[model samples]
Structure formats: C-alpha cells, structure tokens
Target: MTEPAGRPPAFRIADLIVAEGPEGAERILIAGLTVTVSAGEIVAVLADDTGSAAALIQVLAGRRRAQYGAIDAGGAGRSRRIRPSLPAGVSVVAAHERCPDGPAHVVVVDATGTRPAESGAKPAHAAARRGGAVLLVTTDAEVAASADRTVHLNRAPRPERRPKAAVRFTTQALREAAAGSLTAAGVDAERAALVARVLVDADVRGHFSHGVGLLPMYLDRLRQGGIDPTAEPEWSQEEGSVVRLDARGGFGQVAADLAAERCAERAARTGLAAVAVRGNNHVGMLAAYREHFVRHGVVGLVLNVSGPSVAAPGAGRPTLGNDAVCMVVPRAGGSPLVVDFATGTVASGKIRHAAHRGERVPANWLVDREGRPTTDPEELDRGGAVPVFGGYKGLGVAVITEVLAGILAGGTVSPLVHKQRAEPERAMDCSQLFLALSPDAFGNPPVEELLDVLSGAVAAGYPQGPPEVHLPEQQERLAETMAAEHGVPVPASVVEQLGWGAVRTAPATAGGTA
Candidate 1:
C-alpha cells in the first residue's frame, strides 16, 4: 500500500510472529505475516478461524505483544511493545458489534464466522468513508472479495465449545424462589415479595441486567446492613403538590413504589405532583414505577441518580452516575407508552452482567482508566468509565437527572454516593424523583387519537411503504407476553448463585419448569 504524501500509512505490520503453547515448545500460529493498511482503505485478512483472527487483532490492539514484529499504527514509531500510554487511534470491533464513534486512524474487525460477511463489510465501508483505514479479519470469501485488498493466513486453532443453555423457570415459580431467597436473607416476607415482583417483572420484560440476577447483590447488602429491610419509606416533608420521602437507606424498589403511589394520588387531586426520595439504595429498574402512574391514569416521569460510573467529556475519570430516566404515558385502552433508558451509552449493570457471563462488550460502551476505548467488561470496575450517550446531548440528560434526583431531593449526589457492590456494608444514599401529571387536568385532550395519528404519520414518512414501526416498549411488552406463555430463562450461573437447586429437578410443564 502507498502512504500519503506527508502522513504515514494508517498501519504497517512487518514480519509479525504470533505463537501459543509452552515457551520452548511454542506452536507457531502466525508466521511472517505482513500487511499494510492505508488511510481511507479497506483491507481484509482472511483466516481459518476466529481464534487466529482475534490473536492478530489483539496484537494490533496492544492487548498482547507479538513475538517478533514491527507495527507502526499511525505515524507513531515502530515498537514491539505497544504501551497503554500510546496514542488513542486504533479500535477493535468483534463480530456483530457496532462501529464505534469518534475518530480512529485504524479500525480492526474480527468477523470470522460470527456474522454474515455482508453485515461485517458494512461497518468496514463506514470506517473507510470516515477517512480511517479498515483491517477486517474474516474467514469468508465474500468478505475478501468486497475489500480493497485481501491477505490470506494459514489455519489456526478453533474456539472452545459454547456454554450450555440457560435454565428456564415459570414466572410464578421464579418469583417465589426470589422472594424466598430474599426472606432467607433477613428481608421481611412482605418486602421480599414486593422486591421480587419488581425484579421478576424486569426479567420477563427482557431486562436481565436488572432482573433476579441482582438478587445476590441485594442479599449481600441486606446482610451487611447497607440496606435496611425493615425500614419503611415515609413522608419526611409535604406541600400541596410536592413532597419529600425518606427511604432511610432501605430497599430502593420499596421506596420507589411508595413514591409512585403517593405521587399519583396527589397528582389526581392537584393536577400534578412530585415526590423526592432520599437515602435510597439501588433501584432495580425504573419501569416498575411506571405501572403505578399508568394505573392512576396519569403521565409519569422518573429519574434516579446512583454512584458515579460515567465520565464527562474529555475526562478520563468518572464524574457522574450513568443515571436512569423513564417516561410513561397512559394510552386510553392500549399498553402505556414507556420509554426507559440510562444516560450512558449503556447501563453500568450491563457491564456487570457481561462480565458475569464472561462476554466482551462493544468498544464504545466503555473506556479504560486512561480514557481509551475498550471492549473488556471488567474494566468498568477498574477505574474505567462509560461515556454519555450521543456525546454532549446525553451528558445534558445526566446533569438534569442529577440535579433533580440528588440536589432537589436533598440526597447524596454521585460523587458522595457509596458503591453498591464494592461497598455493600455502607449506605448507597442514592436518590429518586417521581413526577406524576394528571391527563384529565387539561380536559384530557384526545391523547389516544393523537398518538394513533402520530404513529400513522411516522409510518407514512418511511420509504419502504409503511414499514412496521413499533412504539417504545412494544418489544419489551412482547417479550413479557412470551415469557408468560413460555418461561423466563435465567442463566445457569445466576441460578447457581441463587441456590435454587431444586428448580433443575422440577417437573417440566407448558411453562418450561425444568
């Protein structure tokens, strides 16, 4: 490949040697592999297996050192050791992962057999369009044919066998098991049942990260006195349309439920109401609170602030919580329109879930301690931080959430809040805000009709002849229906941690008990 007049080639690898196995008896996986990728070029390296593709990409990513080679990524000098402090310009995307945002000198993709070549090539082309060099490692001939250049590598070892399928449990049985576990951990039976319902609801809706997978963490906090199971949320201060509730470092689910109920009731009488909750622990999912307002025939908005996990723009360390935002609008006879999400690219729980499942994440989801993009799920816990979604726009959402949930609620802010998992013995002191608006207050303008017209207009604007467009929460609602008819699939690893051994022996039924 030719280099630009004044700039170096995007990346140049010469005499690269990758080996595995014992030191002296090492097996030569890749020998004398040389390739050059120029800026605005798409180069494909066809290999036999994903294992080989990943090994070479790892060397390029500076995760592993090549046995013998000289790699100059960008205009940087050639070096065998690519230190962590090296300039940030190279990004690695595994199969099925989305193309990362931001400028990159080189984008390496390991697309061996995990996804179709066409799908993998789309991102490579996108990177090239952005004036970045693309190094695609694939096992498919179609992918090689689509690239600007193709390099072939010899066969490498295959990956290990995949893990067993997750165990399935009936919704009722799973809820019972969760409640029982919570009760055993010293939470009162009534509170345990309430918390279990919230968790199982999340699981059935396909939000596994906030589902019963968190029961173990909750149990630990309860046992360690970080969460007071016996404490009840009470109105600490009250006004006409506004109130403050003290969670007293209790279960966040319980506190949020109470706040939602109170807020809805007050809104019904006053047209609008807001409830601020202080001294709260970790709330599983904001969706659970939406149901209360929906049932009360009102619009609901919920905001929550947790411990810091997201970093500010250009900052290497975390400065704010990922923070959650939820909005629910009651539709006359249909399911409520629910929109729920974290302000970060992804929630912190997602990283934890991926780490627990021994999986890598998309590169854009997190940054290492030095602010370089990473795909490692474990990095979030090691001084790594998640970036705000959509850059500065999402940061604005997080800032507003913190102001309302933390400052306005008179509760601990992100920096002062305790880590839920790492410091389970201390109070998290998180905060939540529940706002309810009575639709009837404004004569209940034809909301259902307006929503229908809006949906139709959106579909009409689509180029593909009125494509099926699902409303927010529609996919989750469908998942909930499917789970009710079939069963909730819980990872075997999570089931083991919950100590529900008998579930494996239960008789199989239509709901997939066993």
Candidate 2:
C-alpha cells in the first residue's frame, strides 16, 4: 500500500551496493538494490545470499558503510552512510532478537533464516501497528509474501538530484512584493511597508532566517488572527524613566518600532529610559529595531522572549526559549556598533530552514526527544531542542532575558507562550524589553577614542597583526552594502510559495553567501 498523499517515505535506500574482498578484485554481493518503505508498511528485501543480507543490515545499522548509493531516513537529507549512531527514529533488530522496547519510527529486522516467517512477520506487523515502517531482510518465501511490498536485490535505480538554486530579486522588487503580499493578507499598507523593510534589512545583512523568508509565516499569522494588523501599541503605564506598552496581539515589528521610539524619546528627557512591550508576536530581527534608536542618537539595548525551543543544561526537554539580545551603540564618526545573537548554539529558524531544504545539520546543534545528539533537522519538529551556546554561561544569559522580557514585562513565558508556527491561529503573547541611554547624559564621552583604543589593543595583542579582527556589525555592514548594489537571493521554493516568481531577477554574483 502507498503512503498518504502528502506524506514522504519513512526511509529510502537508492542504488545501494554491497561488496566484498580486495579493492579492484571485489565482488558485488548486492548490486544496486533500491528500497523505499512508506510509513506503517512492511518491506521485504529478498537477497540471493545470507552474506548479502547481513551486509545490507550492517549498513543500515551504521556498523558498515555502503559501497555506493544514498540513504534518507525520516526525510532527513540523503547521505552515503549513516552517522556512527543511526539516524533518529530508526532501530535495528538482529535475527532471533526481540524488538526493542521503546517507540521507533522505523525498524530494520534481519530475519534471513527465520522459520515459517511467522515469528518475523508477527513482530514486523506489530511495529507497523505502532505507526512505524519495517524492513525485513529474509530469503524465506513466506517472509516476502507477508510483506506489504518486496524488492529484489538485482534491480538498480538512479539517484535523484539535489534541490534547485535560489531565485534572485532586487532589493526594491523584493520589498515591494513582500509589502504587497502582506497588505493583501489584511495588514495595513503602512504596517506592511514597515514589516517589509525590517525583513529585507535582515536579508541584506545576511540573516536570511529572519529576512523575507518569514513573509509567508507572517501572512499566515495575519490570516489566522494570530496577528492583529489593525491594533496599535499603546502606553499602558508610565513612571519617571520606566514605561509599559501593550501591543494587544499586534505585529511584533510595529510594537518594537513604537517601543524603541518611545524609549528614545523618554531617554532624551531622563538620560536613561526603559520600555516593556507585552502581547507581541514574533519580532523578525532585533537589530532592525535598532535603527529607531540610531536615528534618535541613543544607545539601545533590546531583548525578546518567545516559546521554548532550547534545552537547559543537563535537561532533556526544552526548558527555555532561545531568546535574543541585541545592543547598538552609535559611534561618533563611523557606523554603529551592533551586537545581536540568540543564547542557543544557533537560532531555531536555522534548523527549520535546513529542514525546509531537506538538509542535515551539525549533530551538536540539536538533541532528539530522548536527548540524543542528531543531525536530522526534522528532529526539531519531533520534540527536539537546541542547546545553550556555551553551556552554563549562555544559559545564564538566556535566563536573564526571560526575567527581563517575560517576568518584568508581565508577558507570557516559555510553556505559556503559544508557538508562532505550530499554532498560527493563536496569539504568541511574547514580550520585549527596550532600553535607551543618551550619551549626552554623561557629557558625551569620547566614543571614538574608546573604539580606537580597542583597535589598538587588537594590534598589540597579535604582534603579526590580528587575523582580520572584526568589530561588531562590520561584516553585516559590508554584506548590506553589497546587497544594495547587487540583488537579494531567496530560495526558489520560498518565492514560488509566496507567488512572487514573477518578480525574480537574474542571480547576482556579489553579496554575502547564504
């Protein structure tokens, strides 16, 4: 039986070959045996010899490498060999061994000499009943008959091609298209333009995860009532140098803009001001909000909290969100110094992007539901979580972010915040904290002198001259400059999904790599 319409195969082995003996004199035991197993289906591989079946099983278990071909398990990208440890959701059961106790999505059973095939077939069927696929390698005729489908070892098939290249669009064209798409989805024209600007700005700075790639998600949220485009951020409370704003489930970009503006205005009078925003949705990128402070000539510090996607140290499950922190300092005679990052090893969006492109990620970036290190990007959707960047130190920063953005702002935290992508119909109810400090309050300290001293320290530290020591925001500025001259490149899949294919331009050679 075939899998459900929109579902991908549980595992697929294409053009796989098993060989034995010396280098050139090696003999092909199993030549290009292709097998595709759908979820909840039992597939039997009928091999000519016991050695061939054993070899194939070894390859599947990651104990031996295949001579050729690719394996894709659980839609995690194709690879020539499985990692030292098998991919997530896959398990191997040896002949005469009982099936493992836990829940595995795919089970590979070696039943080469099982009698009557009833014992082997029974366990395979049981595994399928639990919503898992079973691959039974056996020469027994009964075993082949019991399977949902059978593959012969002699059949060889071709491998599929990789994903297509990204489509390119000029910055103006992409911003216009993104704004139009948002406006069509019920966002006000002004808000749509603002949102578009923030997203495109992130893209030009080489932050694709927060760039135009989020337009589709924002549009979805607009349609589902997760984001209230018509609502405006309003000051809810005020004190000497502290204020609170309620977004009322409005777009995060709008909330962030208003908060930054208010903070800067209040700081001008009070020397330092803090603004807390509650009931906001996903803020594209914190750096984008720094522009408001930059224009107002104030130093800015921003923090935001979201639903949990990062695991705390020594914990198996996610205990905190991969919250973000950003600070921007306007220099006297140069570009602003901006530092922005998530507390986790990587942002959750990076893994999501990898999954969208059918690519694998580094094992250290994520842990499966059982807390096992995995390279499968899809594991994020299966209860996996990203770990803190530098272990305990990063965890400390993340906790501080939660306290400032969630607790102090009186907004929903971790388990309380609805997932933006998973539950688009519901509001995220995340929070943000914005702080503005005026250098004029301190009689205008010599910021340029401080920067020069830092540069000099870098030179002195490395007698041979530091290997291109980069100041904060230096790389981002260079990327943005190049993107302005050339065009922004977006994934073809994303453009097609957003119906902006018509705006695509020729690929550009300049600009930061994606």
Candidate 3:
C-alpha cells in the first residue's frame, strides 16, 4: 500500500512488556522504551531485538492482548487489558516475513536497514501529513535517525548462559524427594504429598521459580508456625455462583485446590462461579488451579495477592504485591491455553536465584532502596523491590488482583500488606480469587471449532519454538512427558535448598537407574 497524504495519528508508545515467547526461553524484546507521536510526527523505533519491536507494534495496534499501562484506580494510561479473550472484530495485522501488511489504524513502514534514508522517509512524512502515523520499525540506524522523532529502546541483552550438565532424577524419585523434604519439615502425610506435588509439578512444567525452589520458603514458614500446619479451609459464604473461604492460615495450595474444586462444580451448574479466599500462606502458582477448570471443560481465572513486594508507578513505596494471575481455557484437541504471570517484571525468586549465582539481573527488574534502577540481585536483600512490568501496565494488573483477591477477599492490600523496614515474616493473611465459567455461558458456539480456527491461524504464522505457540498448558504437557521419559533435572541450587547442603551448584544431568 502507498503512503497516504494527511495529519499524524495521535498515539503514544510507552515502556510495554506484552511480548511473549517460549516459556523460560523468553528474552527482553524491548526494554523500558517509550515513544510518543504528536499531531503530525513520525516516530521510528529502533532496537537490537526486532522480535520485541514487531511485538510492540502489534500489541499497540490491538494485534495482541489489549491492555496497556498500570492498574491504577482510575485506569492506566492509553491501554486496557482484556480477560479470557479478545473482543470480536479485533484483528492483528498479519506480518509478512518480519514486516506487517494489511489495513490498520496505524500503518507500518518496513524498511530493512538498507537504502538511502530519504527513500522511505518521504512516504512516512507524507502519511503523517494525512493525519495517519507511520511506524517505521527498523534495525537500520540510518533509517531510524531520519524519522521525525527516534526512540531507542534499550532492550537488555539476553542473559549469557553458563552451560552445565543437568542433574536428573526419576519422576518417581523426584516426587519422593520433594515430598520427603516437606515431610521432614513436619508436614503431615497427605499435606506433604499435596504440597510436594505442586512444587514438583511446577518444575515438571519448567516453572522452577514456583517449583521445588520454593520448598525452603514453605519449610521456613511452617517451621516458624507462621503458617498453621493443620489449618483447614472453612467456607464463609456459599451463595449462588459466589463463595468465600477462610484458609485459617494454612497452606495456600490446599485452599486454592478446594476453591478450584468448588468453583468448577458450581460453574458447571450455574455457568459462572467465583470463590474469594483469605488467610492463606503463599500459593505456589495459580496455574495448578486454573488448569483444573480447563480439565473440567471450562474456563478458569485465578488472581492472588501476597506481601507487597512490587513498586507502583509514581509511588515512593513498594505498596503492591507482584500479585499473580492465571487464566486457562480448553484448546479442544490440543493443550489448554494457560496464561500465567505475576505483575512484576520478573519473579522475586529469579532475583534470588541470580543472587545465589552471583549473576546480574536485568536492569528494569529491580530498584534499590534509593529508588534507582540496579542490576545487582543483592539489592533485593538490601531492601530493593521488583518493578512493575512495563511500568503502569503491570501495576494495573496488580491493582486488579489487589482489589479482587485482597480487599474483596477480606485481606490487606499492597502497602498495608507489607511494611518497608519490618523483618520478614510469613504472610499469613494473603488472599486469592478463583472464577470459573462454562464456555457455553457466552454463546455456546462450537468451542472446538473456534479454538481450532484460532489455533490454526497461529500455526499459519509459523511462530517460533517447539510446538509453535508454547501455550503454558502445552509447555506443561511437554515438561511432564520429558520428566517421565528423561527424569526431572534438579538444579544444584534446589538440591542445596533441600538441605542436602553440599551439592555442587553447577548443572549436571543425572537419572535414576534404568
């Protein structure tokens, strides 16, 4: 399509992190990059990582998830996050090669770092005059330099890998090892097994941060009686399509599992059900609960609030929990579409892992006590906080979780949930919200066909990575298979945390006897 002649489209691009790739293998496509285009200007975004640049363009133009900015009370800037599914009529301009084509509110100019700057800059200039913004996403510095305004997205370089052999254990042995650790920590038979399964399940699914690595945290909390070892969940409300549960300071997973069970049962009957949970310890990962409903042929949403460890935009304090959210929907013949993430740019566990390994964290992930950005993981221990992902975008999601899971569940929100200088204590009053819905509740159309179509459309794009889309559920399935077939690889760090005390901290693959 030729460039249109009119005034530029009024749009502002801020630091956003809506980009997604293969699980665990994801890298920063764009760092804290912000670009703003006024009434008659063309902004060229240049980044070393083209993947991030393209993803950013798609998300802004409503090609990806439709939410932008922080989860503040009023509304985050310029963007909005949609739950479950994108609205009808929502379409992403399909990209050809690395360039996008077709009609869109914003037009893209794909100039591959080659050619004289004037060749492509002329049309973009013409488009802006016609009241349409031309987004030139290029790696060519010259092309970027010629735009009316140029934004340099300082994307962090991918973390360098220190190759070490993986340490493997039979799936059965891995389960036992995890369960044994909990049991040794004084957890009862059933309880230990339940928690162990979740931890191992996370590792099995490649979410090591939420997996066995958290065992020490659980043990510490339970040992100190910070979490009541035998506490039981009691239903506080069981009204139609809505319920509330008090966890009684017990293991977070137990209450979460119960909530998922009850919600799925109620949703099947009522078509929609919600359960507000309060007074539980840390729930490892919400994915376990969300996927449960998917197995029951429904959609599930889990929002959890914990200690305030996330910094909000414009706030001088770390007043928000990295509050987590997970959503799962059946993909018909394939894996469930499990979307799970915390509001933080990176999980706190990862920072701890970096500290343990003497590795530098990505700059955007941490801010020290002085409120300055840092790459040192040790800053976390010295009173640093995980920054909200994409600034306002992440805070907005955290706010949603804060309201639904904390306040609505009768628990404390952010600033109140955590004290700045207080010593670490087991968070016993954290809250969670579980919502489940029958697919038929909306339109009752053929879900299998709908998903198949969507899945096919994604496949048509030939996205990178194994199994293409890398749906969380799909990743979990693959992880489970690998665990069963090749055994689970327990990191040396995890082994050390398990009280083994002297295991080497390098990766070495090992397996139980055949």
Tens digits of per-residue lDDT, candidate 1, 4-46, equal 4553467666656676753212455565577777777788878
Off by over 4 Å in 2: 1-161, 504-514
Q: Write the per-residue lDDT of candidate 2 for residues 1-514, one digit (tens) a residue.
A: 5434654578777656566653312456666566777677788877666667667767776777765566667653543433443455555654432224411112463232122323366778877766676788775666677888877665434442256677767777778888999988877899999999999888888787788888888888888888888988888897767899998898888988988888987887778999999988888889998767777788999998888889987566877888999998887556788999988778888777666565556655677797755656789889999887777998889889989988998556766788898899988999999999998898988876887898778668876766542456766877777676667767777887898867746356744322
Q: Against the hidden reference, what TM-scores do the models get? A: 0.73, 0.68, 0.64
> Can you tell me which runs of candidate 1 are displaced by over 4 Å?
1-10, 13-44, 47-162, 465-470, 504-514
lDDT for 459 in candidate 3 is 66
**What TM-score would you give candidate 1 relative to the actual structure?**
0.73
Per-residue lDDT of candidate 3, residues 52-161 (tens digit): 55665555445565222311111124432333232231222223225342211223432221222232456566655654445566666776776776666654456544
List the candidates ranked by lDDT, beginning with the highest.
1, 2, 3
| Better structure of 1 and 3 per TM-score | 1
Identify the superior model by TM-score, candidate 2 or candidate 3: 2
Candidate 1 lDDT (Cα, whole model)? 0.75
304 Cα displacement, candidate 3 (Å): 0.5
